[model samples]
Target: MPIVYSEKEASLQEVVTIQEVDDLLEWLLANTDASIDLAECRHLHLAALQTLASARRKVSAWPQDEAFKGWIKPLLTTGE
Candidate 1:
């Protein structure tokens, strides 16, 4: 699965396509202080990004892919 929910870490591992925005949103809403691990993420859908952006959650680990990191970095830091 692309989005792996970890109860112990209170984190979500974004590995591939985070296609279901509503599911992600629901998860985010349920889990406060949820951090995201994008170390192995290949693609993040726009809606998923929107959910993350709106939630303003912490990023526990960044993606290994530089381009993806570059793209998401601004969204993560701009409001802070």
Candidate 2:
């Protein structure tokens, strides 16, 4: 799985596809206090990006890919 969820965090690895968005949202809905770790994320589906933006959780770590991280970090981190 691209996203690994524990009690209070989601670790995003490699690529997070559109198919993972639903489960990702479900997990977010279930755990409003959860933080996200995107240190390993290379890419994220548009839907997944939107879902994460809407969820607006704390980002524990940004992506290792500088360009990717620069693009989405604001969208994900602005409100926090």
Candidate 3:
């Protein structure tokens, strides 16, 4: 399972399947100001990426792995 929706106060970890993207998006919409930590994430499908890109919420951090860090570089730089 992928660590999809995460915040300082709340967290949602589940398989990064197509069906879970909607729930993740909804969670992000509801907690726009929350600081999300995506350090433990494994894989994110295109659906999840789309939802994340469209979301108005702010993520605090990305995974420490170089590949993951590079992938989410734009998001990490854009402050909330």
Candidate 4:
């Protein structure tokens, strides 16, 4: 599953598509302190990224893939 929601974490694995945005947003809103784990994420849709960014969710883990980490890390860190 791309987005796996739990009480404490929202794990993003493999590829996260735009289709997951709505559910992601709902989960984020519902779980205010839920942290996101992107360690296994290979790709993420712009819409999904935007939803996470807009919500200012905390990233619990970053992807191991350097290329994916390079771009996503800044987005998560800079709060932009």
Candidate 5:
């Protein structure tokens, strides 16, 4: 399942699987007020992360897992 983060009455869904990224991206483009939250997820495929990173989307929080954090660190804190 994807992780969704809401801030300031806006919500963003972050997809970590290749299968769902496309759909999520479509949704995101249509709705720019939402925010993505990847901090609670685990086992996100690299390709999915890459797509979000390339788009420069910012995540609301960091995952608690160190490995997961390391993997997504670049994408999250880059202010993207």
Candidate 6:
């Protein structure tokens, strides 16, 4: 799974694709206080990006990939 879910945390890693978006959204909704970790994330499908953008969850860690971090951080933090 691109998203590794725990009791109160979700770590997005590898290439998160469209297939993972539904489950990712579900998990975020279910775990209302959970934070996300994206340090190991390599890529994100637009759907996944949208999910993250709208969910408004706390990000525990930013992606290690500079390009990806640059692209996604603003979108995720826009509402904060």
Q: Rank the candidates by lDDT, best first.
A: 2, 6, 4, 1, 3, 5
Tell me how many clashing residue pairs each candidate has. Answer: 0, 0, 0, 0, 2, 0
lDDT of 2 by residue, 19-69 (tens): 899899999999999899999999999999999998888999999989998
For candidate 3, the 10 contiguous residues with the lowest summed lDDT are 6-15
Q: Name the TM-score of candidate 3.
A: 0.67
Comparing candidate 3 with candidate 5, which one achieves the higher TM-score?
Answer: 5
TM-score: the better of candidates 1 and 2: 2
Q: Which candidate gets the maximum lDDT versus the true structure? A: 2
- Lowest summed lDDT across 10 adjacent residues in model 5 is found at 5-14
Q: How many pairs in model 5 have backbone atoms within 3 A of each other, for residues 3 or more apart or on separate chains, i.e. clashes? A: 2
Off by over 4 Å in 3: 4-15, 75-80
Question: Per-residue lDDT for 80 in model 5?
Answer: 37
Model 6 root-mean-square deviation: 1.2
Count residue pairs with overlapping backbones in model 3.
Answer: 0
As a TM-score, model 2 comes out at 0.95
lDDT of 2: 0.93
Over 1-80, each residue of candidate 6 has an lDDT whose tens digit, in order, gives 78899979999989999999989989989998998999999999999999888888889899998998998999898455
Q: Give one digit per residue, the lDDT tens place, for model 3 in 12-54.
A: 3423668777677767777777655666665567787677766
lDDT of each: 0.71, 0.93, 0.60, 0.87, 0.60, 0.90
**How displaced is residue 23 in candidate 1, in Å?**
1.1
**lDDT tens digits, residue span 58-80, model 4:** 78789999998998787777452
Candidate 4 displacement at residue 29 in angstroms: 0.5
Q: Flag clash pairs in model 3.
A: none
The 10 consecutive residues of candidate 2 with the worst lDDT sum are 71-80
State every prediction's TM-score relative to the real structure. 0.80, 0.95, 0.67, 0.92, 0.68, 0.93
Model 4 weakest 10-residue run by lDDT = 71-80
